[model samples]
Target: MSGLGQSGVTAVKWSAVSTLARFVLQLVAQIILARTLGPEIFGIFAIGMVVLTFATFFSGFGFSWSLLQRPTLCDEDVRFAWTWQLVVGLITMLGVYLLAPALSAYFREPRAQSVIEWLSIACLLSAAAAPSTYLLQRDLNFRAGGLIQVGSYMAGYVTVGVPMAILGWGATSLVAAWLVQAAVALVASYVVKPHAVRPLFWYADAASAVGTGRAVFLTNIVNWMLNNLDRVMIGRLLNAQALGLYNVAYNLAAMPNNLLLGALQPAFLAAGARLQGELDRLGRAYFQMLATIFVLVFPVFVFLALESNDLVHLLYGSKWSDAGSVLCILFLIMPAYVIWGLSTPVLWNTGRKYYESVLQLPILAIGALGFYFFAHQGLQAAATVAALVLVLRAVVVGTTAFRALKLSWIELLPDVGRGMILSALCAISVKAGQAAVSDYEMPLLSLAASTLTALGVLTLLLVIRPQILGVQSATMVIRFFPGMAQLLSRANPSTQRGPITNPVSEQRL
Candidate 1:
């Protein structure tokens, strides 16, 4: 309806396309690597990545969001941000390199030292690209950004990761892919926003950027700690094999969140930032995003939880069967994860990041203690604890977000909750169908049949009670596409006579 709305929609579309492509490619690579290198090797790589993720967060210094959220930016601001990023990146690289031996000793995995060292290069490459990429997002130019991300991931995984895995590189393949992906992203960012590379900095600009980014930086630190605490404890308390199993399960369960909702986060933040002062519009947009994300992601997690055994068998084969149980446990947290994902952008864009960080401290402490205590029992126990903690965290964050937006759960929860109910029903029907077809000879065929039965049940339910999934609101979503409204009207003549309205606006009023 407006330029900002149109740009946001276009950005989300491209982001979805990019995320889907990358998800497929990464999934294929993951299967090949899992089959060839096995879980122990992946465990080692996962440890390195855990360390690298912390390093990458430090290197970023939250400056990207600082730049994006700034009402205005000058050349000096861009240069200062880039300079600081590079400084942080180099420091992080050296820090990881020097700490490698001690980290390896702590993890009790000797190979992790090498993996950590190799992956440090990605931090530097990311820093080099930060300014240009921030500018891209600040301008809402997600098409170019999405293309760059997809192309980099595809080229890296296909050309490097798969071949390295075939050549018995094991964890090295993942590190190689990381380096290639980061390098490509850096190059592409510079290519897209050449002016962002200019090197002129001022002290005042640097100080201003840091001041603006302090809250976000602290929030990210807390988030990283909260997210990785379970993994860290698992790697320490359990063997590489266990950690590997848990890692695979976690990733599998998180796949939908990473690929679908993750794709929309930047767009949400950018759009929210633009509408920050407009409470009514921002509230409506936030609810719509939450509802849409819930409807799309709820069934995915439910299905994954229901058929984790079959899905794991189909994807990673019988060797990873243990991961299936872990996957189910992790899936229990997906609804909370989805809510947190949707709400964080609103908090950050509305300058409530500091408050969120403060609120999260107690939750993080409790969760970390929970993980530490349960990790000794086994991976499944740890996962259960983590899931419970995540649900708590979600409740805290969701409540705070609602209060900040001056909105009530009554306005937001009905649509999203209905979708969850529908998803639960689908899961139940699928479980029943699986039992009915228990004698199916082939696992893959059984899985296919079960999935189809779930979809069929969901379709029937939607047709019978379209409001269960908020069909009116879902139909309005189609308006994001050009001429889609008219096309739908042509197909169903009753649609042509009524004007389209924003569902969240109606509900909010």
Candidate 2:
């Protein structure tokens, strides 16, 4: 590997570990919050997040992009970015507070108004946290950033969610959990990057930062709309009960894709940042990434697609059986979504944010119209529309990457072909297991047996075709485990994490 690739890999290793830990914590938190508060409360928290999401999205004003894209940004630039985030943070909080009643009125849920206003505090805290967090990303200090994430997530889960659950707050417990995590992140930022927190009144850098960040911000907005527009539409057209079930199914369907994509996107961006001027190298890197991500994604979707009913019953309980069909259909699109995840960072890092943003408009329009026409048909209709929309979105962006990288459809098809073959194998194996155990009457045991059978089949396939596992070996991920440290150290001298020094800024994380 080149020095840039090596460093990028190490950063990714740390970031992935951190992200995995956070995902685990979040999963546990959501699981606990789900059972304790149930769908009604969980949905409330989801709506609040959606509302606050818009507020915080604008609050960044593209400051992080300025840091990530600018190779020569200085300490003064860092201070300026930090100041901009702080001011925006305060403004976001005020705006959220003022707009809370309007949001409640629109949703026609009076109880949500207070929840929205109280949760607005998190937007301010998040705003304060953004620039410090960006500095960590810019300086490749993912270990620190990861630690903050782990700490904040754990704090929210334990201190807020658990206690509130005990206190019988139900759905309100989610807001409480969010508030605690935001607070923890706010505090940790100051501790991790103290030097970047220099005081400044509103300065002359806003125009410069916003000008650079506008493209990124616009892209993010489009992505947000594409992602949540369906849910927003569902809530408006259908009742909360239907929306709640859809949310559950949608969450489960998206989980595997989100987990892999979450790890891949940041790493992709970091890798792209290092290889900024070399589109050829960037294209190759992304292709390899697409292969790796889909390798894991394929079996996951297949397993979930075949056993959506059993899995939902096992995890979220039998109350969510209505979501099974939704899960199955959404599962069909998981592989395409995973490929999109890998392709997108290349677009972002290659300064194709405007193009990416434009692509999303058509995808969003298709999704919105599809949902409108089909959503009332049934959960199946919504899921089918969603699956088709994903394929369309992936093709639009994938073709864009192909042309921009001077590649052909042939180059992309091989990886996708392999992914399809793997997914088919996995689905057939899982379905065969389901059929074999169909006579069983115990829900828990049937789920356990089906899951075990599917896993065994997947493991056997990895043994038979090692390349199908994505990594070189089944144990490759074990390198991050403390138990394998000695082995990893002996095999690769350069595998050890090293300190990075930023020449342009003295900010520490």
Best by TM-score: 1
> Candidate 2, residues 258-291: lDDT per residue as tens digits?
7767656766676577676887667666655555
Cα TM-score per model: 0.93, 0.87
TM-score of 2: 0.87
Off-target runs (Cα >4 Å) in candidate 2 are: 1-4, 199-207, 465-509
Say which candidate scores most in lDDT. 1
List of clashing residue pairs for candidate 2: none
Error of 1 at 271 (Å): 1.2
**Model 1 C-alpha lDDT per residue in residues 93-170, reported as the tens digit of each score:** 899888999998999999899999888888888977988898888887888888898889877888899899999887
Worst 10 residues of 2 by lDDT: 500-509
lDDT for model 2 comes to 0.71
